[model samples]
Target chain A: MRIFFYSVQSEWLKTKNSIASWLCLVGGFFIPLLYLIADIKNKTFINSAGTEIWQTHFTRLWMNMSGFLLPMGLILASSLITQVEFKNNSWKQVHVTPQKYSTIFFAKLAVLLGMTLKFFLFFNIGVIIAGTVPCLIFDHSFPKENIPWLYFIEKNARYFIACLPIIALQYLLSLQFKNFVIAVGVGLAGLIGTFIAFRWQYIYLSPFSYTNPFAERSGFSENILLYATIYFVVFTIISFYLYVNKKIKG
Target chain B: MEYCVQTTDLAYTFSNRQQVLDNVSIHVPEQCIYGFLGPNGAGKTTTLKLILGLLRNHQGTIKIFNKPIAGHRVEIMRSVGSLIESPSVYGHLSAKDNLRIFQKVYQCPQGRIDEVLSMTGLANTGTKKAAQFSLGMKQRLGIAIALLHHPALLILDEPTNGLDPNGMVEIREFLKLLNREHGTTILISSHLLTEIDRLATHIGLINKGRILFEGTAEQLKKEKNRETYILYKTSDNQAAAALFARQNIKPALLPDTIKIAATSKENVAGLNRLLVHNGLDVYEITTEKNDLETIFMNLITD
Candidate 1:
């Protein structure tokens, strides 16, 4: 257990030192800043818009930001965590340790998951800032009907839960490829490919398309939750199996 | 006494279908600096990997500390430290931070980080990242990491590959200190004959994935008897050989001189007296001992 914590701490330290983390922070703030300016201008154009307009704008901004940013954040985190070992050819160093493989594997997984949570935290703050601007600039009263704080919590929880599989898949992909570019490229290509496949409506069976669970008002369907749970469990098992069996050569 | 590492009929083939290691067996005695001497592509690194369990698909048995490497791998590996090929370090982390990270892996006390730092002479470069370190410093850091856990066995492959002469001497002295003080069983592989000759007590000379010879340096040196040669500028060469033959001594004939294998300095003087008595003038006499390079060359060439 101590080994696990130490590995996790090391992974977290690397994430903190990464250039990708700075880019995520800058990009996170920029996205919400742009949306807030656009929403303020949109409110000024309307003659009689109420709190409902502001609430809808807030939900849309949060959803859109998370839809794009969270996956990218996961990709960055996964790539960063795996790239450190790959770049320095330190896999042999880690493997020769007395720590169990599961402990090391989960430590990296935890860091990737934690970074994704951090993105959500920053994005939430951005959402609040974006929501506040329209009310201050246009003297618009916030819509109480769309401000379902409990629903917002439940929906974000489902969204975060849905992202677990992508985190696992990204970790696996990054581990499979020593090059960060290949990992990130494959992740982006996967995201785009899944989005395109979802549009065609032919491969609804694909799990990547279901990465975003709270996009609509489905209110966390039992079916989607079940599928996501199975997907998460299956991919987690497969990724760890491959990692444990992978040959460590310097 | 039990061996620190023992292998039986080990073989490994890479993905390119090239046999890197054939059926080779090696025995490393406990607390001895076993020099794994071989040329490039002689399967030294591959053998180390097999012993460390870093590479699988090997058809053989490997036992370290009397434990089967495959069954009790973690338990056995915990007591072993290795620096294979190059130093494995996080280039972005400071020297201190790198030690701290490995300390966690070894589950050692925090003080060990400082201990290894001082031991490897990296104590003064606390804040310097590994990328900024010189090759010798990095090699020291690598040794520091290998020693961090207080491992009983250290397996280093070409530890002095890229270091300068001073660095090599420093490492050699340090390794000697480690062995003398801590009794750490070191198995170091290198092609540098002089370094191994100076350091290793027992050497396993390998060639083409096979053990050519295994013995102490003295034993190898003793394998060939020291032959003495006499450079006699004699008046008649054939008469000199005829005289030695009549005296029951076989003198080897060279282009310019006749050589005789004298047993000792006294024997050389005795032979000179006999040659002078027989009317042969001896101008110069030379003798050479079998050094490691000559012995190694003889072993490989033969």
Candidate 2:
């Protein structure tokens, strides 16, 4: 337990020095700011298109950022965390220490998860700031009736929960490849491939499609969750296994 | 006498079908500086990894402080500090903070952080991030981390690979202090023969994954003297040759010099005086002793 906390703290210190964290936070804010400007210019036309248009637009933006942008951020963060060890030749140093494999593994995992949460915070802050400008300029009543605070929380919660599996996948891929570009490339391919596969009528079978926060389902069916759950568990197991059993060869 | 580390018939082969270590055995005595000497691709690093339990699927048993390393890995690891190749420092953290993290990992006293920092000469660099450190400073920080827990043994692989002469001296002195004061047994690997010759009490010379020689520095020096040669420069080289012939020395003459094998240092002076007394102007007499380079060359050639 002490070692675990130490690993997490050390990883957190490393995360603060990373460029990916800054890029994700800044990029997330920039994208929402552009969307707000477009919304303000077409406010009159958008209001005439009814409340469903606003819902669809908001949902689509949130889904696109959560499913694509957020995962990309984590992919970069995960790659940086793992690649630092390889580039600096620190794995051999750490492996011979008293710290156990599980401690180091989870410490890195905590950093990845923490980075993901920070991205969400930055995304929501951007949304709130962007929403404020239109709310005052267009004399909009804040859309409280159509989009309740509880609904906002529910949507964000689901988006965050759905990211857990991707986080695990990215961690595994990053640990497997000591190169940043290769890990990020494989992550981008997996994200784009799954997104394209979900466009077919067999979307129910696709794990990426289930990432839809607004989908009208209480709980996932055993089959759909099984696909993701199996992958999540397997990747996590293999990541830890390889880490513990890996030979320290330069 | 307790053995800090012992390996029996250890072997490892990489996935690319390259045999890195073949039937290598090492014995590191407690409170001694055991130098692992080898050329590049000689499996020095591979042997260290196998002893540290970093690599599995080996053919032999490794016992650290007399306990098998397989089941008691964590217990054994806690009492060992290692700098395998480079310092495993988080470049972003301050030098002090890096030590603090390892302090927590090993659950050692906080005061040891300062102790190790001062030991490594990083005490004045407090609050300075490790990223700004030079390669030698980074190596010191690595040694600091290894010393944090006050382990019974410290393992270092090529610890002086990239240091300047001053930095090398600092690390060498620091290791000596650790061994003399703290009684920390050390197992260090290096390809530099002179450095190992100066610091090591016992050496294991490895070549092609096999230990070519394992003994004390004195023993190696003795082995070197057995193959010593005497170079004699004389005015009457032919007369000196006849003198050696009369004495049944069988000297080989080349130009103005005669070469003769001498088993002891006393024999070189004896032969020089004999040549000078025999109507020969002995200008110079030099004895060439075998060194690591010669030993390594002989091992490889044979």
* For model 1 chain A, the run of ten residues with the poorest summed lDDT: A213-222
lDDT of 2 by residue, A123-220 (tens): 76776666556777877765443544565676666666666667787788778777778878877887777666654555554444445432334234
Clashing pairs in model 1, backbone N/Cα/C closer than 3 A? A51-A142, A51-A143
lDDT of 1 by residue, B201-223 (tens): 99999888888888787887776
- Compute each candidate's TM-score over C-alphas: 0.82, 0.83
True lDDT of residue A165, candidate 2: 68
Alpha carbon deviation, residue B204, candidate 2 (Å): 2.1
What range of 10 consecutive residues in model 2 chain B has the weakest lDDT sum?
B293-302
lDDT of 1 at A249: 41
Q: Using alpha carbons, what is the TM-score of model 2?
A: 0.83
For residues A1-250, what per-residue lDDT tens digits would candidate 1 score against the true structure?
6667877876676654466567567756767788778877676422234555544555666666655666777677778778888877788877777767788889888877777777766766776777666777777665445555675567567777777767777788888888889978987887777665554543345455455524343433445656667877888899899988876544
Error of 1 at B207 (Å): 1.9
